[model samples]
Target: MKVFICERKMEVNYNIAEVYINKILFSHFWFHLLSLGLRMILSCLSSFRTLVNKSNPIASRNQSC
Candidate 1:
């Protein structure tokens, strides 16, 4: 009976470890996804800003005229 109880304890410990590892993996996945999303957003914003600057001719207009 004691051996059976010990085996059960080990199983429970294994399950707990599995859950902890899964949580770490899940968070890592989310962190990677968030970083990728942020990078995409920054790139898009920079491109849009470049487009706006190119279309805005006020900067090149002569003030002396």
Candidate 2:
């Protein structure tokens, strides 16, 4: 009976550790994905802004004012 109780305690501890590790891994994955998305958006926006300025020099000059 004592051995059975000890085994149960170990099983609970193992389960808790598994859940904690999974949570950490998932958060890291999501943070990486979000940063990549933000970088893509910023790059695209900058390129678009440059294109607009190239097509309209007067507008770009006005914006500098």
Candidate 3:
């Protein structure tokens, strides 16, 4: 009787722990995805800015004039 009760309790605890761990993993996955997305966007913007600067020498000269 005692062993059966103990086994059931352990199973319940295991289930609760699994839920908590899954929630943590889910949040971490989202955080990683968002950081990667932001990095991609910032890199794209920087590349665009450099391309515009390279192609707009007249704009730079006008500013200097």
TM-score of each: 0.70, 0.68, 0.79
Error of 1 at 14 (Å): 0.8
Q: How many steric overlaps are in each model, in order?
A: 0, 0, 0
What are the per-residue Cα lDDT tens digits for candidate 2 across 1-65? 99999999999999999999999999999999999999999999999999987879887778998
**Model 3 bad stretches (over 4 Å):** 61-65
The segments of candidate 1 whose C-alpha lies over 4 angstroms from its true place after superposition are 57-65
Model 3 Cα lDDT, one tens digit per residue, 1-65:
99999999999999999999999999999999999999999999999999998979978898999
lDDT of 1 by residue, 1-65 (tens): 99999999999999999999999999999999999999999999999999988866665564434
For candidate 3, the lDDT comes to 0.97
Q: Pairs clashing in candidate 2?
A: none
**Residue 38: error of model 2 in Å?**
1.0
Global local distance difference test of model 1: 0.93
Of the candidates shown, which would achieve the greatest lDDT relative to the real structure? 3
Overall lDDT per candidate, in order of appearance: 0.93, 0.96, 0.97
Which of 2 and 3 is the better model by TM-score? 3
Least accurate 10 contiguous residues by lDDT in model 3: 53-62
